[model samples]
Target: MKKYQPFLLTILLLALFPALAKSEVPIQKGERLNLSRCVETALRNHPVVQGARDTIRIGESRIGQAQANYYPQVNWQTDYTRINRSRTGNSTYSDYNSSVVLSQTLYDFGKTKTSVNIEKLTTDSFRQDLHRAETEIVYGVKSAYFSLLQAEKNRDVAVETVAQFQHHLTQAKGFFEVGTKPKFDVTKAEVDLSNAVLNRIRAENDLRIARVGLVNALGIPSAPEFSLDDSPLFQKEKIDLADALERAYRNRPDLQSIGKKVEAADESIKLARKGYYPYVTGSAGYGYSGEDFPLRDGWNVGALLNVPLFSGFQTRYAVEEAKASLDVLRANEASLRQTIRLEVEQALSNLREAQERTEATRVAVRQAEENAELANGRYDAGVGNPIEVTDALVSLSNARTAYIAALTDCRIAQAGLEKSIGKRD
Candidate 1:
């Protein structure tokens, strides 16, 4: 993976404006955020998770509409008429009608039942989608958090380097005043100190940019200034590929969602086939009709059966469509499994590589620190040159940077593995 450029640029702007390094948007003491808090905030506020939840409610409404077919439908109606006739002695008369009618589907060969089942399955699928969205946001927060930590560490390294160079410049000036060191040594020390100041400015810029990225990941792009606590950078985690693969297969919400869709498609196919059978409907009504109010009353009930003969093969086409949808879902399920397997493998590879890099950089940091100390000691003893000290400091800085990068990579890789296995928390 490419290094997190946004986080790394946190302090670059500070290089251009050195005064801002000291008072640059100080982080509030009470604004410190941790990984779990960030994840929770994102889940509560992110639009993706909110949309997924809304889909669940939509699915529930569809289920209610499907079930309405099983209940009796009632309607109340009224009509009035007045007529004046010229052909039979010109008589005026009035007629009134009022009625309440109820209709219900007695049987449809389980068509309504199948539709309800499909809706329920679809709702369950969307519930799984919600889970997937939460998981993705958690991983994103973890990545940003780790990158912020890395950038902070790098800033500290830059500060220490500047201090070291300042100390060297002071010593050279002292020696030059006493006529022990040449003018070249003092000039070299001055040059090194200037470079260290430049680096420190860049590191400060990186810290600011990193904070912005963390805020974005938390789903609060306009959040106030904040900081993070120190976290262990080299904690090794042991994982078995076989076990991870099994967990991914069982727990991945996206895969389970696709399976639910396939089941719903099967139900759709059954619903379409119901068109081949006859449907029974029954209706009942009560009414009063007369020239005046309360004149007469009547009641009636009836049942009807309708069978399909042919209608341009619409039923056949519906069944075919359902079958095709099922086939597509199955294909998607297969593709998802392959994708899950690849994710697990890639995460494992990244974790192992990061672990190795962390170890290598850890050793390098120790050696470089020792070398810098030795070089500085030699220069103090009046035998070493400025070049030796400058080279040693550069090596030490590079080692620290590499170690920080490696540690951040390790944390991100672990998060990736957890995501692949659908591990919450």
Candidate 2:
């Protein structure tokens, strides 16, 4: 029974506080997280994405509030009052009143309809904002995922370099003991080995930092340590600049959101102008009023007309303010369109550059690897100097590093381009 007690307690806690369970680490140690999984986790858990979704809900609620004016409003009121007639007869009386009233808008010169339409448009805008948040989260996850991969590759390169230097050191010591290579060869190899070890340490630390970055991008800072599935970083995506620009213009969520805002602003201007017209409201009430029991009962119905009449130029200023706001939104929409074009062009340019670098570095790494092998072989044959061996190894390391960087850049550039074009998935 005691053995089951702890398990029962755990279940009880989880049932009582579901949020506590949600706060636990989302990923398990040694779990392999892929790019898609990371993006999904981010979209599901990121505070920004959650907040954006909440904003959409708020906008939806506002739409309901605006439409409420089209429906009848009911209210019930009860009050008791003690009146003193001292000025007339020094007499006091108690009065009680109770009433239930229903009021509905009869006409508002399209004001209610326009207001509801504006709210609907604004809600659509918020939906687009949510899409934008999702796109941004996806891009952040992709960029961080690629960065972690790059760091992992760089760390591997460092480890390999360290191993090669260790081998060289062993070869140098063997040659010196056999009276073939100078003590200088042994000393140089030792120094190079030490430097490679230092680089490996730095690389390991960088890999750790990259992992932290990836976890942050996942929006799960307390997630357990996990491995990532290696994605193809060198794959080139074929995209036309014209097509990308067109897609960005057509699909960018920020642009779409702003466009919706512009439409809403147009309606806002109309709503503001409606202040110059009269609005009609019809009301009906049933009530009982008396100072004692068995109170008299009565019912009444009436229609009220509200006119702006004279408002000290308040309506004029409201109309001007609305028009100015609309103008501002239009300007912003134009600026956002231009910004989208620039982003698409920049992403495309970066992707092209990274592709070119990847191809060039691929060749460089191959050549450097061959050169390192030849240099090591020649040294083993007592034909190559320690300087040549060291330079060849360094060149190989640099080439590998460059290749890793190019691949990472390619992946990040693709992510940026997708985000620029508002690729939600």
Q: Please name the candidate that would achieve the greatest TM-score relative to the true structure.
A: 2
> Over the stretch 1-425, how does candidate 2's per-residue lDDT look in tens digits?
99999999999998999877765767768888888888888998899999999998999899899989989999998999999998988989999999999999999999989999999999999999999999999998999999999999999999999999999999999999999999999999999999999999999999999989988888888888788888656566789989998899889999999999999999988998999999999999999999987889999999999988999998899999999999999999999988998999999999999999999999999999999999999998999999999999999999999999999999899999999999976
What is the TM-score (0 to 1) of candidate 1? Answer: 0.87
Model 2 lowest lDDT segment of ten: 19-28
Q: Runs in model 1 with CA error above 4 Å?
A: 1-31, 79-96, 290-296
Worst 10 residues of 1 by lDDT: 21-30
Counting clashing residue pairs in each candidate, in order, gives 10, 0
Candidate 2 local lDDT, residue 409: 97
Native-structure RMSD, model 2:
3.6
Candidate 1 lDDT over 1-425, as tens digits, reads: 34877665766776777767645433334577767777777887777788989999999999999999999999997899997888979998999989999999999999999999999999999999998988898888888888889999999999999999999999899889998899999999999999999999999999988888877877777777677766545566889999999999999999989989999999999999988999999999999989987659898899999999997999999999999999999999999999999999999999999999999999999999999999999999888889999999999999999999999999999999999998756
